[model samples]
Target: MSPLIELRGVTKSYGDHTVLRGIDLEVAAHEVISLIGASGCGKSTLLRCVNGLETIDGGEIAVDGDVVSGPGVDLVRLRRQVGMVFQSYNLFPHMTVLQNAVLAPVKTGLCSKEEAEERAMAMLGRVGLADRAGSYPDQMSGGQQQRAAIARTMLMSPRILLLDEITSALDPELVIEVLNIVQDLAESGMTMLLTTHEMGFAREISGRVCFLHGGGILEQGPPAQIFDDPAEQRTRDFLRKVSLAGRL
Candidate 1:
């Protein structure tokens, strides 16, 4: 079977500072992958590129056998199939949680307002935000807001999920609740590609772990091999620093 997501020789840059350089990867259906590395290593950019938020400079990216890179691609369509959750909860401040969750489906004509609300409520309930449906973004804690953002993304029934350091902005105490939700998604066989600093959670939940370094994926393998016995020197050094910092 074709990979659910495919990137070949992908490259991206902002002026001269390239973020991703010839990044190639393949993810299968229901596979969970974690991209781990220091900041500015293109983890977030890679996800953005895949979801059509950032255009690539070179190479090709395909989702489910259809090309998604370069010009003329239907970004809205691409994003619907490949959902993304970012570090910041970008909810509409004026909208209540239920309103925010239903925006995409209703705006895109995917469903009527009533249908969207029902679907959004179910997703909000799944993310443990049932009680917050009537609350605005400012009324919720950081964790709760993030959960609402996740529920908003999931309401579209995306085929693949891209998570970009979803826990970095939250207080440490609130991190567990968000990670628990992601763990539940992983266990439910959601296809995911996530950039994360939560090493332990990534190791515990990812089917495969990829170490991104110097604008490319330096090494990737099963979690045990990548974490315990990685093949690349850079991967070893990176893990050592993470270990020393008590992040691994």
Candidate 2:
């Protein structure tokens, strides 16, 4: 079977600064992969490019066989199929959780107002936030807010999820709740590509792991091999440093 997501010679640069140099990857349907690397290694940029949030400077990106990079692409349609959640929990401050989750589907005509609310309520329950549906962002814990953000994304019924350090802004104690939802998503066969600082969770949950260095993929393999037996020296060094920092 062909990959559900494919990148060929992907490159991105911002004036003098370059990120994601010649990245080539393929993600099968239902596969969960984590991109691991040091800061500025272009992991997040790669995800954004995949979602068309950032235009690539070179090469091509195809999702489910549709070319998504370059001009003439319908970004709004692409985004609906490619859900993304950020570290900052970008929930609207004034909207209640239920209202936030229901807005998109109702406005886009994906569902009627009543149907969107029903679906959003069920999704909130799935993320353990049904009781908090009426609460505003400021009234929730960091974990709850992130879960709300995730619920909003999932309600789009995306074919793929791009998580850009979704737990990076949470307290250490709050990280697990978000990760647990990710764990559930993976087990439920949600296709996901994520950039993460949580090495243990990546090792535990990823179908594969890629180590990015100098804006390109340096090594990629099954989690055990990539995390425990990486062949590249840079990969080894990065793992060792993060391990010594108690980040592993």
Candidate 3:
């Protein structure tokens, strides 16, 4: 079967600063891939490009064999197939958790309000936030809010999920709850591309770990190999720094 997502010579730039340069990657069905690198290494930009949140300067990105990077693409359709959750929870402060979760599906006419609410409730339950459904964002902890954000995205039933540092904004104590939800999603066969600072979690949950450097994937392999025995010098150096910082 063809890959669920593919990037061929994908490139992205902001004026003279290129974030992603000729990035080629393929994500198979049900595979979990994690991108790990220092800041400014293009991990987030690559995820943005995949979901059409950022336009590429060169090459192509395809989801299920349809090009989504170029002009005339149906962005609405593309986004529906690829759900993204960013570092910020992005929930409406005034809306209850249930309302926040169901807003997109209802507004997009993907389902009736009743159906959206039902699905939203079910997703909230899956994320362990069923009781918080009636609570507002400010009433919940950072972890709860992020899980609600995940639930909101999952309600779309996208073919793939893009997570760009979804736990970055949370307190250290709250990070594990969000990671556990992601781990559960992985176990349930969700195809995902994530950029995370949590090395141990990435090592445990990702089937393949990619080390991005200087606007490209410097190295990629099974987590054991990539983390324990990287073939590239840059990969080793990056891991050493992470380890020294008590992050690995």
Supply candidate 2's per-residue lDDT for 242.
Answer: 92
In model 2, pairs of residues that clash are none
| Model 1, span 76-110: residue lDDT tens | 89988999999998999999999999999999988
Model 3, poorest ten-residue lDDT window? 196-205
1 or 2: which has the higher TM-score?
2
User: What is the model-wide C-alpha lDDT for candidate 1?
Assistant: 0.93
The TM-scores, one per candidate, come to 0.97, 0.98, 0.98
Q: List the residue pairs that clash in candidate 3.
A: none
Q: How many residue pairs clash in each candidate?
A: 0, 0, 0
lDDT (10s digit) by residue, model 3, range 148-199: 9999999989989999998789888898898899999999999999999889
For all candidates in order, the CA lDDT equals 0.93, 0.94, 0.93
Error at 141, model 1, angstroms: 1.4
lDDT of candidate 2 at residue 247, scale 0 to 100: 75
Taking all chains together, the TM-score of candidate 1 against the true structure is 0.97
User: By lDDT, who's the top model here?
Assistant: 2
